[model samples]
Target: MSATEVKLFGKWTYEDVMLSDLSLVDYIAVNKAAQSFLPHTQGRYQMRRFRKALCPIVERLCCSIMMHGRNNGKKLMAVRIVKHAFEIIHLLTDKNPIQVFVDAVKNGGPREDSTRVGSAGVVRRQAVDVSPLRRVNQAIYLICTGARNSAFRNIKSISECLADEIMNAAKESSNSDLAAQLAVSAATFQRMIAQDAWKFLKYMWVNSVASDIPPLTHPWAWGLPVTASLTFSQGYAIKKKACFAAKVSFLHRINEHVLEEFYKDYRVDDAAMHVGESAARVILLH
Candidate 1:
């Protein structure tokens, strides 16, 4: 298992909020406000996590309001107030609904003044076109989180497959003078392997991170490219370094399930063998 690389697009800032002071009712109200901004169709997919995770933060904020309303005469304990405050901030700052739900579980459910929303329809919904960029981002997130769908993994694998397909086509083509056929030089092809390999691997790495996986550190955790260039002295070193960088980036985005899978997929024995044979040879010989 290698360190997951953190990419600029996936980074987020963390905020601190207290969770203790909020009562259940306050959370419901805040959720209502946030829900109003989301489109109907999108809301359908988002509400569950929001309700589960963010409601407590609202409750805490409401408690603070109530305390202030009482003219500061009644003192709320710092532990409760601070706890709920953090919860509120956490809910507000969280961009991903799934992450929000996970946070809620860690914080425990809503506090007193509970007002449950029935039928899920209480939240307004809206329609919005999903963009290609958004889809790509989501795919990256899913992979970092270590999602288990084989089909999804296969889809991510397409980039690597395409690169190989193109290279093979170039090699087999008989007409060297064919002007329409783009010529990919050996250096260009190696560069493509170096760049695209990391891209595809990073997506997989990020998915593992998002799922809370510990990350794969073993050198052989992922299958090695069979290309001759990849097995060469400099080529192997580059690949290993790329993998190592990716692993570090991934840890910042860790999710529980992803961590579990990392341990399962990457074994110490395999890693040792691959690193000794591939990485050591590359570094030593080059």
Candidate 2:
């Protein structure tokens, strides 16, 4: 029989498995010649530079699994572990194991990385493009490494951990969470600036007119109003690009009182005006 006629481990077939990512089609070598029941290439790819890219992707994964701890120098053990993991992936996801594995590689691969450059202690980090072959190699290495680490202390077996990691990686990866985190971070930075500004203004109010202004009544009597108003103004100004829900969420987190008053007094369009006037009255009066 030809190489294509053999099933992987006498069970899974590579018939319909295709690379959905067109850019990675050339880099990820998946074809009849590369598929085999036993994916051992016997280090022939290592004899020539760049020949490793022609090796089967599953063989690369098996080699990565053999990198650390007790699994080191044990190719058959790594192969058995990967085979069991693929079976688990098939049972849970009900999809082709090869397709899931390919998607995981596509999602987990890093496109760019930083390297140190320059000479004589003037070195700086510069971003560099990761070659396609290296990207696939790194992705397999990381997936196997993560599976090993997770299985180290936990009661879960390596096969289960590996299956879970591959399935999670294959899920659609997006930047929506990152964008939300950035919005919150920007709002936090604005709050810090508002706090500093409020402190300076409070100092000026007290020192400039100690005789004109009476002693304080309560802690939130005057300071909180001024601070909240200033925070709203500055945070709104800084987060104009953020979504309206994010802005409201920031305001609600910092001060619910200000948020309620915000809706009651000026709504949204006239918020800056109300905040400016409130702060001016508090600062200019004293």
TM-score, candidate number 1: 0.15
Report the CA-based lDDT of candidate 2 relative to the real structure: 0.62
| Candidate that would win on lDDT | 2
Q: Clashes in candidate 1: how many? A: 60
TM-score of each: 0.15, 0.59
- lDDT for model 1: 0.32
For model 2, residues 1-286, the per-residue Cα lDDT tens digits are 4544767787777888878777778767678778788767686888888888888888888888887676578999889889999999999989988889989888776665545678988974453556778778777876787787788899999988888878877784431112222222333333323334334333444444345333343323333333454676654433332222222222323345544554454343232323333323322232
Where does model 2 exceed 4 Å of error?
1-4, 172-286
lDDT (10s digit) by residue, model 1, range 85-155: 33443355544322332233222211111123336668422212333323222222222122123224576
Candidate 2: minimum summed lDDT over ten consecutive residues — where?
A: 175-184
Give model 2's TM-score versus the native structure. 0.59
